[model samples]
Target: TMYELVGKEMTDKWTPPWPFGKKPTILQLDELGMTDVPQAERVNDAIDDAKVETAVLQDILPDVGFGFGSGRAVGSNNWVIGGNTTKSGMPLLANDPHLGIQMPSIWYVVGLHCKPIDGSPPFDVTGFALSSSPGVIIGHNSHIAWGVTNVNPDVFDLYRIKVNPANPLQYEWNGAWRDIKVRQETINFGDGQSPVTIQVRETHLGPIINDNKVDKETGEIQGFNNKDPMALHWTALESGTILKAVTGLNEATNWEEFREALKYWDVPSQNFVYADVKGNVGYQTPGRIPIRAKHHSGLLPVPGWTNEFEWQGFIPFDKLPTVFNPKRGYVATANQAVVPLEYYDMLASELGEGENYAISQEWDYGYRGQRIIELLEKLAPHSIETLQVLQGDNKLISAEELIPYLGRLRFNEPELNEARDWLMKWDYQFDMDSPQAALYAEFWMQLANNLFGDQLPEQIKLEGWAREMWAAYLLMEQPNDTWWDDASTSDVVETRDDILVRSFREGYNNAVATLGNDRSRWRWGNLHTSTFVSNPLGRSGVSFIEKMVNRGPYPTSGCTGTVNNTRWTVHSGSFAVDHLPSMRMIVDLGDLTRSVAIHTTGQSGHPYSKHYDDMIELWRNIKYHPMLWTRAQVEAAAANKLILKPAN
Candidate 1:
């Protein structure tokens, strides 16, 4: 089916076939399930292969979805400009990590100060830290400040394990039958429920996460059937010195020390943007990215019996994408591709001639990254105030990319034409109060659904960011492409124009129906809103408990691809913002006292506490609290003090 749409060459190239024999038929796209077809697989000759490599990689890789419960896409924006481009003649670093919006919030804002003991460096860092973690995850010390955006490298892989049918506990590895490691894990439900114990099977590669499926109705485990099980080989499984890296970063004084600290940072790769008191700006992509065999692209499952698809080793930390004081004066990353094609080539030359050096194929579209760079270039001589405003930018680049196609379409109905004309004149900002934004949002969702919804089944259908980008690509570059034809309408072949006109009419009608016929009353804020939900309690479904735990359906701005990334899914047919900047932070290297930050919710976990929801309004209003650095500033602002003396 993919071959029919994108042709054999493009399909084969993008969604590479199973490296073993015939590809296995998968019933569902489960975590341990085999790859069926890449999500939103496409063929666009006009776009450079290097540019689309990440999207193609995403398509081919099995979509296990975000490990977190959220269906929203994971992305963030982080950039640092050199002193030359800053008004204060000091680097300015800004970061807003897009994550699930919650009540207590994922970030725990705290200032850690420790006097040097045993001739060790004093810990005087201040910024966001996880309650469970020991040190600040992202922040600055006396000498330097840094921020991070996820790299989303292809560090995980699935292998089709060949089990010896005769001996269920044995698997075929390198032509020899080897014993599969089995571990019994007992999950204890401490609330007086019976404990359940299950067997976890593991091959030499790693754990077989889907060794057994559970029956939904009975809540019973269904053991492996005739089908071969898949084992996960992820970098996270390896014992990493991540804590060591964190502590090293907390104490690091300069660029060289910061890099040395990152050497121990393995697993869950991130693009670390750096700025220091010395007026230096830098970036480093540090992770344990696996190097696959020459034949494997890390796209689909391969036979575990042979070493052909096995990872040779990890890409060395030094060779990973790194830049220091570049000629561009700034380095920005929004989960987009960090390196050029030549970087891979250089790796191939250094590490063996034919080894695959794909650091990762799963990267976000460059809309946010492109937008950040554009703003950096356009608004030179940056300051903390300007950088804070930049963090709240709500311009949707995807709308800009797709709206031109609407202009080219000639609609028959007068109402449709009026709507089309209105959209054509829009500035493509997803501002909360903009009526045009509401109309455009509806039209774009309908257009995407009309274009590809018919072709893709409900189970594997494209949604949200991926769907938006793919639809835009097809409309812009491949107008007459076969994907334009609606599979449901068999009588006549549909062209791009035909689909556009039909979708536009349907979208306009749907918008009017939902938002009332009076278009002026329609506001994007009415549809796009954020609810800060408390975990377990918020999901309890009891009205009173949910009301106490959950925070607002607050009017929000921005879409999936904006710098102020308020991500929502169109698959659910609701514009309720799910993923957003969990925390916004701007570190003014010029003045550490001027640094400011705010999370979606508040610092306290207690719902009744005034500090619990205090930050919500400030966050919604794009305001931030000062990251007080000096002891005098901290004492001056302190309302209450609980000093802890050494218990002797």
Candidate 2:
């Protein structure tokens, strides 16, 4: 059987890819001291013997040639508010993590409304969980609300192991022989009801990925690289970190409680943005950060089997760098660079090394993050309307610098004159009907793709920068009846002027092909689609792999009139942020908390449910469904509610 069939089932029958150095097998209940051996094997063996082909997931990537466009369709953003800045004088928080716009979409929405002990007296929280988990992993608890963005910080490490030629599962940990921890788990192999068992191994460094076997030629283990820069991470499984965060969250009576709650966090690193009913606000760079030797950097993997590169200790939470309710009246996080380059010294001084407190390397803090900071800095007397505007802002100034260089082009037989004039009168905006905006966005993206083609030749394969300029330009320009009868990207092969024509040809071609030739055929909503599929825990498996896209654009407004989910385009980027928001309970936390969250898809994890796809239209239209938190709220939520009492 193929190793690819592993982990296809969600049962007590399996174990995770462990890093604790303990790999075990799926023991049949009968063999584990159960009295009924025959009955146990009957249920288990039937699943193990089903013959099925393992060719479904052999490719390294499902789609290789077409690079992601629409400018970072796969990133997330967040911002939090503390009590010191709220009208209610209580803290309030909000966040929206952008990610690769997947088909069976990654985020799931749910709400918890019952009263907890004596907390927030019947208040409710509406938020999402990462599909597999049951509780609201990110949401407003009761007294406060929190949002998270993938830290995307580098946190794991892989060690290149010297394998014993005879025993592949064993590798050298430190000048000595050490066997990787091995564990086996059963999975559904697709044919009939049969399941199969697969072995998993973890070395001193991490799990054996790739083919579950070392490559004979490179001697390298595949997968998350048990020897790469990320294998060393175990934050997700760290009990201290997970328990501390959860217990702390349970006691959070206000913003301060929330801060203490974050102290026990581990795994799936995040940027904590918070706000409470008390008008308090705060931000925490949450996660277990390893205190490594000053000589080592988390940017990439380091050598293992040696003492040189190792985690020194863990960082402390009290000293973790965070921004409390600043008198400035606003705080936001977008997984962007929190500290600007120029302000590095200032950040260092105000926040101390606090390295003993864990930091994350899941995502590097950079550009888009910093841009969000800069955007927030420009707000005046911040209002919900202003925050909404910020989410969907599509004004790219870089286009102005490149358009003039195109020299001569013809449209309407104006022979470069009308074309130039059209561009000259243009303001770079992706307004739905704006032709100049569309053409400019596309052209700018094209010119950029044309310029940087051969920079990184060997290491990686990614879409070039020049292509981005072309993509940004497409929003403004569309073809017309004149000098060019829709120039197909497939036709151009020469430099427009010392520029790499081939790359732009490809980038331009991609943009042209996916979106139509010119203005008349171009539509941002058409290209910016969202998919919602159901994987049924791990049982149904990732939605037939082929039925990935169940829905398309939902009258979304991104790229121009809106950059994020606005009142009109909530589906593409929005989520519910507060209960009793926008009406009676407006705490005046400015517009930050009341941003009225949304997503391009729905709340159900079930792919076939009508409610699963119902939210799309509401999201596209910038509308919201009342988040039910109490019994009355839930009852109102269900036009059809069914209560099933357990049979005695």
Candidate 3:
């Protein structure tokens, strides 16, 4: 049906043809011994069919893994304000990396200081580091302070492999049979269980992540029936000098050295924000982003038998996005698109390209970035106190964008009209104590479901926040669009206004039912809460163990896309916060001693330790502890110290 709707060229060249016609399936081709068909064409056909099937299955099947919570709102918020915009007359840098809420938090705060030795640069850094990682992931050295947010680059691709029918160990490459390299990996259990081993097949492209297709009922891997196995080509898999880059960053003095250090950062690309004692602010995007073929969009799997869709090497480090002391006096990134369209044009012109210079299509919705910019511009001459307050902002731009539509809708019921009036007079903040926030949250969720739930598949349905915001905004101009009509109701054609009124009434009723008839008692915090859960123990299923290991379902503010991002899943039909700012940090180059930071949980990993959950209240309340930088300050704040000795 989709194939007929889209027509032949669009389906054949771009999207896969849906509801596959009489075209021979992958298994059928192998069984019938269709060697006359070109391997490249055969593989492409198989890939198309597989893509269509996967799409269909994803639509109908219940979501696997974390279900609705699987798409935990991603991306971090980081910004740097130059001396001109700060009260201290020196740059100020703020960062809050958004991540899943957990105990023994993702970050381990530490201050590493090493005096210059053996003609090496002095190393003095303070900030957050991954518990398992070596150097400071985001922090400030003596001369400069830096923060990082994910760049969200498209640095990986899937290549559909065409296996040789004669020998399963071989695959087609440029019309010739190439041996598929097999690596044996054994998993040894700690409890003395039998070691299980499996063969990992690899092509020149990369490892075959999706190997032979298996029958769901029989649980048998049908070897020959698997016509096209996909091999993954990811930048992270390639050997990189990320460790070298980390060490370099820890010791780097100025913008020049900072830029030089980032050259070695090859994987997990990041937008590095810089602020130094020299009153400078800068931004740099560094990583090995692949330059793809002109025809390939990198959105779907391509034929591995041919070199047409192969990557044409990486974008040069020097050519990557960078800004030094911008005219705006500030730099910020929230996993949004880094470069402008003009940047791509310039890159193409300079590179003399028949290749696509487009870095990635998968960037954030830019809501956080926009908010950060808005604050930075509106509230200039910022100080440590002001910046700290800014980090706690819970205003939702999505609400601001969509709430106006509700004002125009006329409700029939008196209660519905009263609820609409109350919502209309409210500020768009997801404050913990706000009753209007609670009502609006429920209304927003209901509106999203009413609009797209019946039309789109379960997996692809809009689940409120950014996706729904964008959809509603676009559809607002087209009142008579087919999507506005309720698919479930055939007798009555509902317009956008009709759906809005219906959703409002339903949302009001639902909120009243959940929070009671008294509207004033409906506080956002009652439903929207945060739980700092411990791994293994918290999920052990025993009530006592869970209560002992997990922190409170604490009242919290903010929603998805807010600066104070405490994310909850609407698809789960629960308002409990699933993700939040993993760690918050503010660095004042004007006064490093004044800098402060805090993570979701405390420093200690031990569940029984008092330090385990000490910082929870402070983090939730947007409060912070001083980031001790100087030796004197560190010594003053030290509660206990341990000494190391060499075993003679």
lDDT of 1 at 201: 88
Q: Taking the tens digit of each residue's C-alpha lDDT, what string does model 1 give over 1-648?
A: 344454554433333221111111101122112234332111111112222222322333354322112222467878999999999999999988888777789888888999999998899999989876789889999999999888777787778888888988888888999998888999898458898888888888988766667788997888763375778798877798888989999999999999999999886788899999989998888879888776676755668888888899998888777878876688888776565434455566567756777765555656777778778888888998888778988888778777888888777788888888987888888889888999988887787777766765444445657434644554556667666778888998888888888878888888898899888888998989999889878888799999988899998988888888888776778889978888889999988999999988888899989888999888977899999899999999999999889999
Pairs clashing within candidate 1: none
lDDT, each prediction:
0.76, 0.43, 0.76
Model 3 CA deviation exceeding 4 Å by range: 1-72, 187-196, 212-215, 218-225, 459-462
Worst 10 residues of 2 by lDDT: 577-586
Error of 1 at 419 (Å): 1.7
RMSD of 3: 9.8
* Candidate 3 lDDT over residue span 327-410, tens digit each: 767777776656543455556667855777766655555667777777878888899888888899888887888788888877
Q: Which wins on lDDT, candidate 1 or candidate 2?
A: 1
